[model samples]
Target: MDYVDTFITVAEDCAAQTGVVPKPRGGRDTVAVLQHRMISAAPYRLTQGDVLFSTWLLQQGVDPATVPPEDPRRAEFFAVDRACLRASPLPKTHGWGLHFDAEGRVALVAVDDPRYADLHDSAGKVVKAMRSSRAR
Candidate 1:
């Protein structure tokens, strides 16, 4: 079933712009991974991603017993903006596009996959994607 309050499909011919885009890695990739896990499993609002990602990072590669709540890095991960996913490498580096459902949950669609055409055009919106470079 297709729902239609917000017509926005993220897939497009980004080939020309792809070269200009930078691959997201390090911390950015970390944020993206967290977001992807949530979205792929179930649609989630951005706030959920922020809290979960912050919490999840602490458990990785460490013993929960010794980890301190006051670690400086905790604040950094906690500060990661959910908008970071919009500019994620999932589209530019990985050739996959993302779109939100009627419920405002994100899902990735392959940019080159013709089967995803149904998701390309948002009836009322012009559509937009993230730029790889910062505005400098």
Candidate 2:
């Protein structure tokens, strides 16, 4: 399956597990927003391996926030981390990069790229959701 399919599949599973529904929107904009949210809401306790995979998923338009806690996609997601994929290594790829910080929260660096910036606003919505959830 292509990235879009992978993203939708993962999103569906995440929604089922987390009870967080992803609003469907047409075009690249929706994908971008979802991807940003995934990166931002991913659990800080993720293993280094998970962190690497989460980064790759972010590029592929998977939102961590929407990921089902028990989704199999998370296995593949974490696998990428084990492989240690790097954005600088594949600069030509449309959406391939890993951005994380010492705090484990999704750093803004990933969104800084022109390709990712467009989704920042939508991702902000997801971040708010995450904050609310954490506050509870």
Candidate 3:
């Protein structure tokens, strides 16, 4: 679900005390790396849907140019329930927090950044990132 005026804090089980920039593994972008690239490159410019769709497109090796909004691919993709940013590894492992503005545009904030603290304390809604592992 898209969150408006919400701040998703780092997971309680996250080990990193500060935000760590995710790196490509095996010279290929993993989901976390792709998300980091997109969110960091354009803070608050893209909504949750935009980030999720773009990342999925890149991972599928589908050129976005070939799949216009009118294409059925997007509809087919979203037809099934997809996890939201709360499940994203950025906040769960990479020490980044996600802030959704009033318009639901998302931005990345480092866990240790003052802005994160401010958002955590002041956002209209606050939620923690989903834990990486199930609790024993």
TM-score for all predictions? 0.46, 0.27, 0.94
Deviation in angstroms for 4 in model 3? 0.9
The model with the greater lDDT, 1 or 2, is 1
Count clashing residue pairs per candidate. 1, 5, 0
Model 1 steric clash pairs: 7-122
The 0-to-1 C-alpha lDDT of every candidate, in the order given, reads: 0.47, 0.35, 0.91
Q: Name the candidate, 2 or 3, with the larger TM-score value.
A: 3
Instruction: Tell me how far the alpha carbon of residue 48 in candidate 1 is from the true structure, in angstroms, after superposition.
Output: 7.9
- Sort the candidates on lDDT, descending order: 3, 1, 2
Which regions in candidate 1 have their CA more than 4 angstroms from the true location? Answer: 1-29, 43-84, 123-126, 134-136
Measured on C-alpha atoms, candidate 2 has an lDDT of 0.35
TM-score of decoy 3: 0.94
For residues 79-132, could you state the per-residue lDDT of candidate 2 as single tens digits? 553432221112112232333334433322322255334433323222211111
Model 1, position 77, has a per-residue lDDT of: 62
Inter-residue clash pairs, candidate 2: 14-67, 14-68, 38-63, 38-64, 53-81
Q: Write the per-residue lDDT of candidate 1 for residues 1-136, one digit (tens) a residue.
A: 2222332333243454222223346645454454455455554343333334443664375433364668776567657754434455455444555555555445555555653466665433325456555545
What local lDDT score does residue 10 receive in model 2, on the 0 to 100 scale?
A: 18
Candidate that beats the other on lDDT, 2 or 3, i.e. the better one? 3
